[model samples]
Target chain A: MKQFTVHTGTGVPLRRGNVDTDQIIPVRFLTHSSRTGHADALFADWRDDPSFVLNRPEHRGATILVAGTEFGTGSSREYAVWALQDYGFRCVIAPRFGDIFRENALMNGLLALVLPAAVVERLWDLVEDDPRVPITVDLERLRVRCAGVDEPFSLDEEIRARLLSGLDPVMETLGHHEEISDYERRRRPTLPTTTALLDGPLPA
Target chain B: MGSTLAQKIWEAHRVRRGGADDDLIYIDLHLIHEVNSPQAFAGLQARGLTVRRPDLTIATEDHNTPTIAVDRLIQDPAARRQTELLRENCARHGIPLFRLGDPRQGIVHVIGPELGLTRPGMTIVCCDSHTTTQGAFGSLALGIGTSQVEHVLATQTLVMRRMKDMSVTVTGELAEGVTAKDLVLALIAQIGTAGGQGHVVEYRGPAIRALSMESRMTLCNMTIEAGSRAGIVAPDDTTFAYMKDRPHMPQGAAWDGEVAYWRTLRSDDDATFDRETVIDGSRLTPYVSWGTNPGQSVPIEGSVPSPADFADPQERAAAEEALTYMDLKPGTPMRDISVDTVFLGSCTNSRIEDLRAAAEVLDGRRIADGVHMIIVPGSAEVRRQAVAEELDRVFTAAGADFRAAAGCSMCAALNEDRLRPGQRAASTSNRNFEGRQGKGSRTHLVSPAVAAATAVAGRLTAPSDL
Candidate 1:
């Protein structure tokens, strides 16, 4: 996990809605066992088109991605966010995001910012006009600042805490292992136990 | 206040209620497969953690296994290593695995309910996104990432955020030749793909109750395409009857006790939902997709939608893009679209009933010229049953390939079974996303009956056409 605060960098535009996880990183590239270095896999399908913004040399090092509404709309593959982060992007601005993708992005320290459709359009227009203009996404203040325009954004309190503190959810949830075990014990007498199922203690 | 069934399940499984945000819910069942389980086990090993409940954890080799030559060795080395890794990891963690040659081995979602591991009023989690398919048993099933999989494996607990409730009530009986697949596809087209985001859709009504257990599974299976993590139907007499005498189901007095508890898992009469929608099942026809996404669909009798049909500019652009990619004209009738292949296996529609439905259409008839059709059973049990019923012979005699090896063959394109570039297919799978079946492969999602009929016609057709 990586701590996320305020990130300032040049932005690029992906002016397409419903950019699904399949387009982010197709299943063909998922064969590797390691999690890192997926940046080369980002948007493999679209990168072949020379006109695609990410293929341009000017947008090579952009850290902010301005996409259309409903970005990351298919599959719960966490690799989508991993690919984006490995490509040097820190935040994605969209009108809406898929629920599972949003959760995966937050857990992986890739900030997904939801802004109004009008604000997102403005950001895209600004970035397209001046490809080198730096956009500052301040998570501390819940605002996105670019080209003299500052817009407010909000995140769920729990997700905010995790991003700011670099919290590992698996570690945080393990603290309640005792309670989970206690519940399992209580369920043993009443519910169907896996032991009974495997050993034929419960009749067929 | 009265509570919905989802609320009731949440309250029962909640170990602790966190402030204003989320709750810690105890998981009853955790299923894993080869593609998603290896990295999770790696995470566990890194932390020096053992599986909290080995008995509750289940693994199967499905996504990466070949659909032919079950007795022969796996040809793909990378896929073979993944299966080997899963076997090694499960053995190392003391977890039971249904290996490739095992009779119980199949798709994780299929085998879970088939083995009676999925029960009413439980919380299930898996690393694969289609884990929501288990909600057919009236459980709150969810798909999690690798990190969450590691979390569940270590602690058997998940920190879950509460989702809004949406009730979809279907009234009226389904017309003949209209299957659950059609019903669900119609709903997705109406609501679009993102309709169920941040909500748990509860399917209820006369039509839903009339479906068989397998039909219910079909309805629940594709709910993920609607962007929902969970979709459920309260347990009823139909559910109880389906669970009776299963190998893992409780027996004697325990059975009666479980049924009594399951009966109380329904939503209260006065319960309210955050949103509500209604569908008249009697009017729906066989549906098929014309474009890349699942939501880009039309009824068999309708024509491809023009961009002018869309009110949203983004939607209009997407329609244009889909047309260009699909190489389809806006005015072309859906039934006029021909296919090069017909696929008949996926988590959505590979059960015994689905096979029988396709067999009925293929019985005593040859597939159209230049068309290749393949039928893969849902599991070894389904294959055995189909063989006993002579459905395999029916498919083979009809000039179709009857494959016995079971897994997600063309659905994920992770194995030897895949569509070649520039191929067109009428498939019984859920997704038709760009290159889902294979790169440059065009897919039109259809029901098993429709898929079989399309095989016989070399074009999209409903069973009525037969």
Candidate 2:
């Protein structure tokens, strides 16, 4: 995982609210084993519409996505976060995000910053006014610097630490292997082990 | 202080509490499938780690396998490769896998419960969002991403954040023609798709308790559509009876002991939740989605909502976009909406009960002209039961396709079954998101009963409408 810190980039205003995982990267794109090459399929359906802002030349090479509330609203597919990252977005600013999507984004080193809806609206306006204007998302400072507003944001402390240290949670979790084993042993012995269960025909 | 069902389960599974933010919860079971596991296995290999609890983890082929032509090779190279990777990874890791041709092969959510792997007071995690379906057994089932899947594969533990509890009390009896699908749709429509975010919703009250175990699973499955990662219903006689005689469930004395434990899994009389809401089941009609999202819904007897009805600007804008995308007009009668296809299976409503419900409605009626209906069972077990009951002949006689394909068929459109562009469907699957069924395809979420009636009427209808 890449270490997330202060980064400045052009903002692409995805002004739609309740943008779901299906819209981010359709389920068809999820067929492959490899995670790369998702950028081509990002917003696959909407990109075909000439009026969609992401298709416009002005938003090309944008690294910051300013979206409305409830971004990544449906599905727990991490491909949504991967698609955004592969499409050159290092950070996404939204008033709110679906809980699972936020976790997935953070785990992938994609910064998900929550600001007030009013602040998000301002960022969208600023980006729309000048797509070339650099927007700074500072995970270290928990603030976004853009369009003359130094907006404060909040992220879960442990997630912030994980992002800063570039630590894979699996390693941290393994530290408690003894505890996990103990719990496993303490669980009721009545439950059948996966191996003990028959893969036979259903009972009558 | 009396503990709620969720709290009791959480306490039972907690390895340790990690400050104010998170807890170290041990997962009793971890499920994986083709689409999500390949990358997780690759991640493990890259880290030079083997699976920690192969005995507790299970894999199945879903999402990418062809529902039809099970005997033939998978036609899509990408899908086939993905499925093959799952086989290779599971083989190499010594994880138990129900492969494509296996009699036990099915959707991860369906097989887990049918095999009795999902029991009361357990904590379950899977890569698929609909994993919440297992929570109906009074387990703390949650959906995790690929990264978390790798975490569980390595440690079988998740650093979880405790969710606030929201009690959704459904009062009164379900009106005639209203199914669990209708109740859930009404909940989502009432609370909006994001309403259950940051909370674990426990379905309670007389109406919820009255539902069958299969129906409870249907309700729990759609909880994710409400932005909740998990949902639960307290274990009772219904859950225990359903688990009995399953191939995986414990036998004899162990079963009695487990049942005794499960009986204690309910909320106490004075247990309080962080939030509570009441839904009148008697007032719920057969609901259906009329827009690009699940929240954009109205009763079958209702009309398309005008954007002006929304107070939020963003909501109003979304409604406008949905109207345009769905090709619907304000005040248009929802029952008058016609469909080109009727899909009667998904994790949300593909169990035997759902199949029986649809078959009951389609026993003798023929699907209307130009309207094709397909019924895909949730699992091989369900398919076997449907065939034993001769539901296939009834469906085929009524011009509905009766494919006993045991994977996600039209739900995610990762398989051979998919909707064509500009086609409209009345589907039982969750998530009516744009392009969910297929590119340019419009989906109206409905129950199996409504789906069957719609197929015969060539329009959105309920048995009551008939």
Candidate 3:
């Protein structure tokens, strides 16, 4: 995971809600290796449509995705966030996010900012009216600031700490090896014995 | 204070609490598949780590393996390499593997329950999101990332934050033609997909209690769709009966002791949760997706809702956009929607019971003209069971395509099976995102009976319509 503070770029106003991971990076794109070539695959089907906000050249290099409530609601694929990040999105501002997807994005260092529906609507309208309108998301302050509005948001504290420190939860857990080992030694006897119960009874 | 099932299980499994955020909880079962294990195994090798308890870990080739021919797997070199790597890793670590040719080879989620490996009060983790399916038996199951998989491989424990408890209670009985699939779909539609965030949901009430083990698994499988960490049903006689005489289940004297422990896994009547929602299941009809997401759904008899009715203007706009993309007219009854394809088989609804339900609906019917239908079993065992019951003949005679087994086939189009562009499909799978079935292809999530009826009618129709 990369450790870099978020600086929200121009928001791309997508009026759609419940944008699933499948649409972000279709299953076809998942067949390939998980290298850095997936930026093109981000919203592959939608990019072809002339009406899509991201398809417009005016919104090129946009870093903030302002969408409606219940954003990122399907499949628990972390690649959706990866694709958004690779496509230069710094923050996803929505009324709400799918729980697993939010966890995935936050842990992988992508910022998912949730605001009130009214506030999100304002951002959506402002960005839609002018595609070049900028929104600033300061990771340090955990706040989003647009032309007329400024409000604070909160992310899972554990996720925020992990992202800031560039620490993987698994690796961080293993850092205390001595404590884990000692606990295992102390609890060994009471722990259930392993058996190939699929094969037959345990050997006495 | 009264203990909830989650707290009881968590407390029982805790190795130690090292810090404010560090609670080392031991895991009893670790399931792995080809898609996510290679990276974790690679990470382990890089760190010179050996699997702490190889016996506790099990690996299988499911996601990437071609379902048609066991011998023809090498045709796809990339997929072949993944399976080969899984085999090599399991062999190197002395961990047991149930590969493609093995009778035990099936979807990781299906095999775990069928073989009695998933038990009450166990802590189960897998690399796949549907790991919550195991929670049906009163376990605390969840999906973790590759790095966490490697950590579990080396230490047999996971450090995790506890989740708040939320209970969704359903009373009354399911109406005829409604299955567990419909119930879960209705739940998501009502909850809007993110309603259960930051919580562990326990399914309660008489309606949930009446379901079979397979039905319970189907319900828990979609808990992730509702943004819940897991959904559990308290253990009862049905759970024990399902586990009896299975491969890994305790027997003889140990069985009595295990049952005594399992009996205590339920919540006390007075136990409290952080939040609770109640639904009357008797009123729910067969449900289907009408828009892009699972939450964007309606009962079969209801019309597509107009975006203008939305309380949030942004949400209203999104609904309008989804309506445009799906080519659905607001206020149009969902039953009037026509479909060009029908798919029956996914982790969500592809067990033996699902097949039997569809077969019952398709026994003497013929698929409508120009409408394509396909049935891909969830696992080899499910396929074998269907064939033994002659359910495949029922499907084939009904003018439906009976294909060999595969994962994510039509459910995701990850393999060769996909709808042509502009085709509308009635799918017994999860997710109906834009272009999810194929480029420009429209999808409506449905139950097997509904899929079969829609195949015969060439439109979205209820099983009773047949």
Candidate 4:
């Protein structure tokens, strides 16, 4: 994954609240084995309207998504984050996000920024009023700026470090192999393992 | 301060504390299914990494498998290929798998506990969100994403930021006809869908303690809908008895030692929580969601709420849009909502007890003239037990399609079974989001008994209404 320090792009506003992962990329489109080729699957159902925010010509190249509260509220699908990234979105500004979605986003290097609802509402007004408004989201500075409104955002300290440096968590955890091995050894005799022979004598 | 149950499990699993950012937590069990593991395996292969502890991991073919007669080869090329990939990955990595036709095969959450692989004070992780269901055993069961899945596959540990603790104490006893599903739905409606955000909720107090193991699973399973990654109930005699006969449990003196430790898995009397909420379980009725999300539900006796009734503009907008998509009229009695389809199976409510509860309601009477009902058990083991108990005969005799193959079925709509445009349903599944069952499909979340009753009445009817 590439590091994310600062991103500059115009914004599109999706005013609907509780935009769940099921709506982000419906379950029907999750059949492919590979994770790529999901750009069109983002809001595939809603895009049929031709007037939906993502479909509007003015927001075509927008990389920031300003959605209402409780965005990405269902399913633990990583494809939801993949969809946003494939569709060229670098950041999503919402008042709140589902716990798992935010975790997925941070892991995959997509910036799921949470600002106050009032700030997000103002962002919608600014972006909707003028589509050409350029927004800058700086992960290092933890700030988001749009016309007249420059507000600070907060991320979990650990998450901020991962995104700023683009760390591979797996590789990081693998570095502490000795610690894991020690923990495994010290686990209680009562702690069962799937490898134990079925109905076998318990560890003593 | 004394530790809560979640804190105890967290502390036990901690491999090392890393600065102020996160901790390295060892994963006790990693459950994999077809939908999410393919990409993770591919990533592992790309990195020249191998599964560190294949013995501690298990795989199943559930999410997209068909629920038709006795395991016909999956016809959908994509779904079939996904299942095939899982088999190949597990084979190459020496991981054990329960395939589609395996008698032990079922939804990941349902099978883990049945096999005695999910134990108290352990940490469980899966690629699916409903993994919270296993927390009924006093474990910390968390749902993770595919990237995290690959991390755990390569190294049996997950790095974590600290989570706040929450207590949802359900006081008093549940009413006679009410079920665990009803109690959870009522709680979600009281606290919005994102109410439990960033916290691991521990269910306690009298009502929760009185529930059976299956009932506890049913309650914890849907905690994800409220934005909590996990929910847990402390280990008690009920949990011990349920684990005793399961396949992987320790035996003889070892069992005694395990139970003694499990008894200490509860929150200390002086434990403190970041937040707490109390619910009167006796006041809850059968709940049915009228809108898109799980939070937009009302009791069977209540009327649909008007969007204008909301104090916040965001909430009012959400309600208005949900009403539009649901095609429901405000002030209409919830019992009067119509449905052409009724589905009764999911990780949330497809255990043997859930099936029996629905079976009792559908024993003699048939579903209404035009209503279509599908009864798919959570697993093949569950299906076999239902058949042994003759629950299949009851379901089929009641005009419902009792399926032989056991998998996710219409719960996620990854198979041939799904709703078409403009169709409505009363589903016993966890989510009622738009297009969840199928495109343009509208769902009303209900319990098994209510699903059976609604099928008979062709509307959202409760067992009491019958």
Global lDDT of each model? 0.86, 0.89, 0.80, 0.90
Q: Residue-pair clashes per candidate, as listed?
A: 0, 0, 0, 0
DockQ of each: 0.47, 0.71, 0.33, 0.58
Rank the candidate models, highest DockQ first.
Answer: 2, 4, 1, 3
User: What's the iRMSD of model 4?
Assistant: 3.2
Give me the displacement of residue B13 in model 1, in angstroms. 1.0
Lowest lDDT sum, 10 consecutive residues, model 3 chain B, at: B70-79
Q: Could you estimate the TM-score for every candidate? A: 0.97, 0.98, 0.91, 0.98
For residues A93-181, write the lDDT of model 4, one tens digit per residue. 89999988988888888999999988988999998899999999989888998889989888878878878889888888888989899
TM-score of chain B taken alone, candidate 1:
0.99
Q: Considering every candidate listed, which one attains the maximal DockQ? A: 2
Retained true contacts (fraction), each candidate: 0.28, 0.72, 0.29, 0.72
Mind giving the per-residue lDDT tens digits that candidate 1 earns over A1-204?
Answer: 778988899999888887888788877666555567889999987888899999998887899999987788766677788899999999988998888888778878889999998888888889888899989999999888999789999898887888999988888877776787778767745554444445553222
Query: Which of 3 and 4 is the better model by TM-score?
Result: 4
Q: What ordering of candidates by lDDT runs from best to worst?
A: 4, 2, 1, 3
Give lDDT: candidate 4, residue B106.
87
Cα lDDT tens digits for candidate 4, B1-466? 7999998888888999976757889899999999988889999999999999998898888888888866587778988899899999999998888888877788999988988889999999999999999999999998999999999999899987788899999999999889999999999998889899988999999999899999999999999888886899999999999899777577899899888888999999999999899999988899999999999999999999999999978789889999999999999999989899999999989999999999999989999999999999998889889999999999989999988888888989998889999999999999999899999999999999999999999999999889
- The DockQ-derived docking category for candidate 1 is acceptable
- Stretches > 4 Å off in candidate 3: A5-11, A55-59, A122-136, A145-149, A182-204, B16-23, B74-81
Superposed model 4: Cα runs more than 4 Å off:
A195-204
Predicted structure 4: lDDT: 0.90
